[model samples]
Target: MQQQEIKALLSDMSLEEKIGELFQLPSYFFNGDMVTGPAGELGITPDDLRVSGSCLSVVGAERIHEIQQKHIEKHPHHIPMLFMADIINGYRTIFPIPLAQGCTFDPGLAEKCASIAAREAAAAGLHVTFSPMADLVRDARWGRVMESTGEDTYLNGLMAAAMVRGYQGENNDFSKKGALAACLKHFAGYGAPDGGRDYNTVELSERTLAEDYLPAYKKAIDAGCALVMTSFNTLNRIPSTANRRLLREVLRGEMQFDGVVISDWCAVSELIPHGIAADEKEAAVLALNAGVDIDMASPVYLKNLKELAEQKRIDEKQIDESVLRILTLKNKLGLFENPYKDGSEADEKELLLCASHREAARDCAEKSFVLLKNEDSFLPLKKGKESVAFIGPFTDNQLLYGSWSFFGDEQDCVTVKAGVTQNYPDADVFFAQGCPTADPGTNVLGFQKTPPKEEFDLQEALDTAVELAKKADKVVLTLGEHRDYSGEGASRADITLPSCQLELFHKICEVNPNVCVVLFNGRPLDIREINQKAKAILEAWLPGTEGGNALAGILYGDASPSGRLSMSFPYCVGQVPVHYNHMSTGRPFAGDYRTTRYNSKYLDIPNEPLYPFGYGLTYTAFEYSDISLDSDILHKGDSICASVRVTNTGERPGTETVQMYLHDVSASVTRPVRELKGFCKVFLEPGESRVIAFPITEDMLRFYNITMDYVSEPGQFEVFIGSDSTTSRKAVFSLC
Candidate 1:
């Protein structure tokens, strides 16, 4: 529909109808019965469903078709209801979680997975996906870190843009059958909650907010993301849902995001509990005025918007503005022309979990496994030459898909035991459940319910595993946090393996000299103990449906491990918010502990992480030469070429990600010790060498200054080019 047509439709809508378009309810509200149970308790009535602009978390093509058909028939304006869900990674053909995808360091691959997810989701009648979470996370204790593309702002922005493109298709053209509108969330520093707690206060300076958190969302918006979801946290003492400075002035104005803004699940009404609003009416008024176009799963908009407008307490124009944006999105999705857009039972059957998608998932899973430790080159195990003992809870477990995979069933997932059997049929493979992922009485903290108890005696399981370990030539000890341990509202105080699993690991290590640990988890864990004990460690972070096959491929030499860490793995839980790009302090730890104790250093542990960001290992070793610069000076509007010769020194094919980092020696504000500016991935055969070059431009050096100005100060900058953030290969250049 054209602007004139949408405007005319808006002009014809009754005040109640326009106001209703701003409320998004769950699917059950439109089931042709009075809203009952939990949904009914929200004060939502059958009449509210008839005029609601969209439905949340609705699935199945047939169900969506039925609900949409019924909705349009009763809606006074006949505006089609938008069906939205949290399709973060994949719909049915589950891929790696966003954090794992970040480890791939391949934006193009991320885009491909998102495209496949969009295809599967659109077939199931989903019109919008609340995904491509652009939050920059540093704390591993925050369970939702699993959903974010790790700590770097640049990488997160790049991946966010790629996913936005993948979901919306080229040029935001939703006319394509498989394309679905993408929504970037949770807006404005949702990842940096105080104490790493979910929905906690986020107090960031305006400079830090723009310099780190806001760029990723802006990148997604610039890539034509159709909507933005307000975060649940309070940014700088103001609830994000009602922060006019954040939503209106910064988001819509500075970011130039014209997309429809929706509140995070019930965040509009949550303003009351946040101490910003007196009641639901005030909450609705605050959110609506603050530029939230839709109130998701909240009663604030439905119950008070109309009354507030009638009483002149709130402007009716706010309702019109929001309703117009909602209608614009519907038109962009081509829903006006076809209410049940691309939703077909046959399509859902053919598209979801298809062979091609599984193949893609397997390939992506292969690339996402970060080989954190490969001591003595113990991995890529010789198949027929050794008897392998697979010991742990995840050895045959199918719960590989992490949290927020609402539609993915565990039965369809392949197990590690099954993968080995299928890939290496002749190998002598023994299996035992050494220990459960967690103890039966363990608290998962926040919304995740207690998982079913494992019916096994602890002593018996330990004895069985130890016996297998002693008999076998190699012990593949699989261990990790339970799937329920990470994701929204699931923060943890201890980011380490459970005590039971640790005990099992110790028992196995005592019996077997050659032990390989494969970790299945969501967030980066404190693996200091595992690092010291295991001969080899593979960080296979909750690989999805093809997880088993992917791990087997890496273990048996079918594939090479190339994934790098997007977030740093800390030495212990005490280092909760560690990252590579931390600001330089006056008394920085210089790593020469013998020199002085007065510097900014921990007395018990090193300030550095156990594994820094961009750290990974492959079957082959890559040697980097000294960094070379084309010139010693970089003037305005000119570029400086920084080059390094990388060679595959080891005896197998591998992929290496060469990272480029820069440090601003002096600035108006304290800068990070080293910031990742750019990186490139290269595949190399043994004895192959290539010289990679990166152009250093002034635009890449710009940052938000103390005066809130985004500019680059001319100074002498140091550049480091090598494997990871801790690389010491450096060259100096002056930016004039």
Candidate 2:
């Protein structure tokens, strides 16, 4: 539909009809999932579903087409309902969680995964996916950390842009079966909730918000994300859903994001609890005026917006504006011409979890596994010769899809035990359920599957694992958080492995000292004990459908481990937030007891993370030469280059992520010790060498200054190019 047509439609909508469009009723309004919406509980008739702008979590190609057909028949304007779902990491052919995908450090691979998700989801009749969550996370205690790409601002923005491109394509074309609209979520500072608690208040300086958090969101918006979702938390005492300064002034006015702004689930109505609104009516008015176009799963908008408009307490023009944005999105999605866009049962059956899609998942899973510790070359296990005992909670459990793959069929998931058996038919592979995943009563999120798939008695489970370990030459203990432990509503104060898992590990290691620890959780864990005890540790991180195959593939030398840690793994949970790129401290902590006095060091534990960001081990080893700068004095207008010769010194082929870091010698405000400037992945065979050059343009050094100027400062800068952040290979150059 054209602008004139949308304007005419907006003009034709009555107050009640317009109010209906703002309400995104949950699927339970009709699906019997739960009793929700005005139609279900507030005495509104079934016809209320007709004008509802969208439906949430309703799936299936036929079901969607049926709903749209019935809705258009009842709606006066014949505007089709938009179908939206949380197609976060995957729809059916699940891939590694977003964080693990970020570890790949290959945006192209991430893009391919997103493309597969978009294709599978669109075929199932999902018009919009609330995905490409562009939140920069530092705290591992936050369960939602699993959903984020990691700590770096530049890396997050790059991944966000790649996801947008993968989902929506370059031309914003949704005409194809795989293409669908994407949404940038948790609008502002959702990742930095106080104490890393979910939905907690956030208080960040504007400069911090602008420099770190807002870049990823802007990149997604610029890449043509069709919508933005308000965060559940308040920003500086103002709830993001009702903060005009953030939604209007910054997002729409400065950033020029002329897209639909929707409230996070029931966020608008929660303003009463936030103490800002007197009632639902005030909440409705505040959100609308603040530029929230849709109120998802909230009663305030439908119940009060029309009444407020009639009383002149709120201008009807706000409703018109909100309704206009909704209409524009629908038309742009080509729903105006064909409501059943890209939704076909045939396509859905053919695409979801197909061989090709699962292969992509496996390939992606292979690259996403980070070999955090490979002491004594413990990995690349012998397939047929070694007697392997894989005993743990996840040995046979198919709960590998994590939290967001709501539609994922667990039965299709490959278990680690199964993968081992399949890979080496003759190898003696012993298995046992070592322990319960988490401490009892930790699941506050009300996880659906009442009986966890696998559980074992404390002593019996351990004794059995140890007995099996004694019989085998090697022990592979798989353990981590339960399925209920990490996701949107899940938050943990202590990010540690469960006590039962620790007990189980001890029992197994008592008899069999040569053990491989395979972690299967979402976020970075306090693996200090496991790292010290285990001969090798693989951070599998909720590898999806082909998880078992991918895990075994790495263990059996089918693929080399290339995934680097996007987030830092702490020595303990006491260090709630830890990262590699921190601003320089006046008294930085120096190693050793004598040097640590009067410094920014901890009383007991070291300030250093257990494993630094960009840290990973591969089968092959890469040697980095001294960084060479093109010139010592770099003119302000001219670009300088920092080059390094990287050689694959160890035998075997592998992919290495060559990362470049820069630090300003001095500035008006202190800068980070070292910031990741640029990185590239290089695949090398043994004895192969590549001279990688990072062009140091003035723009790469730009940062928000004390005066809020986003520009570069002319000064001497240190350059370090190597495999990870802690690399000391360095050079110096001066910017004139």
**Against the hidden reference, what TM-scores do the models get?**
0.99, 0.97
User: How well does candidate 2 match the true structure in TM-score terms?
Assistant: 0.97
lDDT of 2 by residue, 1-736 (tens): 7899899988988777888889997877765533354465665556666678899998899999998899988899888999999888889899999999999998898889989999999999999999889998999888899899999988998999898888886588865668878889989999998888888998888888998899989988888899999999888889999999999999999889987898988999899999999999889889988999999987788878777888998988888888888889888888999998999999988998999999999999999999998889988788777888899988988888778778788998999988888877787788888777776544454534443544446678777888899999888889888766788777788777888888888778889899999999989999887988999999999998999999988988989999999999998888768899887888887787444678888788888899999999999999988988888877767898899998999999999999999999899887889988899999999999999999988887888888999988888889989889999889998878
Cα distance off (Å), candidate 1, residue 210: 1.0
Instruction: Give per-residue CA lDDT, model 1, range 197-265, as digits (tens).
Output: 999999898888989999999999999999999999998799999999999899988989888999998
| Alpha carbon deviation, residue 220, candidate 1 (Å) | 0.7
Error of 1 at 110 (Å): 0.3
Residue pairs in collision within model 2: none
- As for candidate 1, its clashing pairs are none
